[model samples]
Target: MDEIATDNRQGILTRIRWKAGYMNPALRRIADRVLKAPDEIKAISIKDLALQCEVSESTVTRFVREIEVQSFQHFKILIAEELSQGSSSTPPITDRHVYEDITDQDDTASVLSKVAARYAMTVADTRAGLPAEALEKAVLAIEEADVLGFFAMGASLLCVENALLRFMRVGKRCLFFRDLGIRKFSISTLGPKSLAVGVSNSGRSISTVDSLRQAKAQGTTTLAITSFPDSPIVRHADICLFTPTVTGVIGPAEYHESMVSKIAQLQVIDVLYSLYAVRNFGRAIEGLERTSDVTALTRY
Candidate 1:
């Protein structure tokens, strides 16, 4: 009806071209159900649609609102209009695609391609969805903190370690805790001037959450880089950066998702680091020069 709402509806259809990867969970579920049975949903009642999706009527209502529809009636009208115009946009692949791609690949190249594509998608999704204010908060935290502590469990530890090294090279006091006991002990000592960054793909790692909680309780600035926004860890964080997980059948092969999520986390950290270097370029250069002089005699 209104110009802004009209624009959102058109935008939603266009976003479908990028797949529904950026849609919130509730809206995504509704989109998936509707796309699967476009013809049937065009005439179905909202109550029946909720029953079919196993979600509440309010969820359906919220989904319609997300697409800028005034109500279910308008939503159905738009759906019918699209259908009549022969709209046949395909919904994005679900968890099944992740499993299917891995199980069906016969060559190393093909497997690697799929894995690379997933990571690329994660990066694109992360960049597309990242909010400007969150980026600014993270940058400011890195800039003003007296110390930076990184906590990550499982393979995510590797990404945190790399980030710690990068910051250290720029003369920032950075530490990565891979041991759960040591991490908790360290967190207890953080103060208002310190920053604690936790990385978890699912955002549900118990140890990581505990570490953040401890840090926050001590007045430390806590930030979380996670795939799930609803994760408990985010509640305690001063800043929350999200990454989209590539869902697949649960198993060892889920490592693919882990890797993609890590890339997204690292991209965020990279931006923070770049901003820090720019803000303190002169000081960083001086530190690099001093380090070079001390190590000059040891070089071959």
Candidate 2:
């Protein structure tokens, strides 16, 4: 917690949940209540919050420090900043999936609206959780690396491969090793001059975990793009960019892969690509011209 993550003026609760797994039960309860009822929490005093959460006043103070804020007042200030951005009460997690809560009785318009709301919130939350300093370092690492290795499995593979093509078209050396057998070998080839970017929506992909582990072992700079900041994949990363998702709907509560999760990860992909392209305008244009010329005649 040496580098405190202050609100880059977007939001801070999601970032608090990012490290929630390590929090004690009392602190975790406080974190949950803050996210569950932001507006109410805003109106309550610290002592009242302690009483409400059934913890002592000092426990309330500990919850604030667990999230890295200097004091309870500072933590509330960050919450106020987020609320000023227009999200009042927390939204319920219903209708996050088409199959789970949806039924034949549901109308078409209702289905469309709920799905749209889910996507909108997922992107908004992910954007809020982004740490500008970490994003800057990730972009600069990719831009300066001798090569960038893309690692992923299942649905996340598409996002990583898309990143490879985007970086390649912009004149960057990018690697895409789709076969699991060769993935670790390829990872071992990288060193201090390379960047290994692993995309894992769950942050528990076997291929992703092993590849990132090898990348770290070889001294390659590693970046993990995931929804779970405290997941195993993060253990091997030099830096991490967190994505937001419908995590509450997963596991024994109910189960399904979320479309919003994939879209959120893609938003991170687009952010990285946009930042790199802006930073290297001339080279990007040159590479685009070279690639477009080869396919230009086919387009008529």
Candidate 3:
């Protein structure tokens, strides 16, 4: 989150001007009106705003998302907040410690504190960003699939492995491949009854996207768990679940080196596993207990 200038009358104008050049023609028109006449625009409906901008209602929706406001109502709330803050400057609400890299000078206390806070924010933002309807649909798809194939690359691969460990216990057929060539072969074997999950935060991983593409081609339902909704992976996915792009307060890289995206991805897995187990608790408990009992003999 960014700070607002409390006393500035033209804060909205400044924000629009800052992002205007980056926006296309349609979004620019929307931004211009909000910047030039914040009070009037705040009172208008989205339909009226679309007519004023000479764009479709959908374009207005896209503009709101482009501006990173959750909705048109949310954008108006921000404008109202700006108006209410007329002349008093407030302290920035965030810290500069986000996505910080570790250094030789750091001690155990600093490392622990930074790591804890980062996980806290990462989990919170991920929870907020996950679309509930999409999540339910993904869980249902997995439950109905004859086999579930997970596709991931590099560090992202670990997130899917975490899912594999949990999903396997539910007595469902799950599959993956560490080798890219082998992975594609496995994807080719899936059909309409299969579900392919492409796990990529950026959604541009060639191997992961390619796997989803092939899976879709075979009539398998594809689910994308990513931070980017507009990424190539989304095009191939039948359903898309977004995660928060939590790099840092200062706009760092795609994700933190400590694997905040991994945390986000794992959280989705946790939710899915929980939902699936609850839906089939009797079978889930039996499977878990049977596995536990079998493994316990070897453990002793």
Best by TM-score: 2
- The full ranking of all candidates by TM-score, starting with the best, is 2, 3, 1
- List of clashing residue pairs for candidate 2: none
- Model 2 lDDT tens row, 54-109: 99999999887766578777787677766665443333445243553455556999
Q: All models: lDDT?
A: 0.70, 0.75, 0.74
True lDDT of residue 268, candidate 3: 89
TM-score of each: 0.66, 0.70, 0.69
lDDT of 2: 0.75
Question: On lDDT, who's better, 1 or 2?
Answer: 2
**Cα TM-score of candidate 3:** 0.69
Candidates 1 and 2: which is better by TM-score? 2
Weakest lDDT window of 10 consecutive positions for candidate 2: 246-255
Tens-digit lDDT string for candidate 1 (1-300): 463454343333323322333356666777777755666777899999998878899989987776556788866766676665443442334424443246533478888787877777667666665677778888899888998988888878867877876688778998765567787778766789999998887777888888898899889999988766445787779888776553431122123345666787888788777777888999878767767766687787
lDDT of 2 at 204: 82
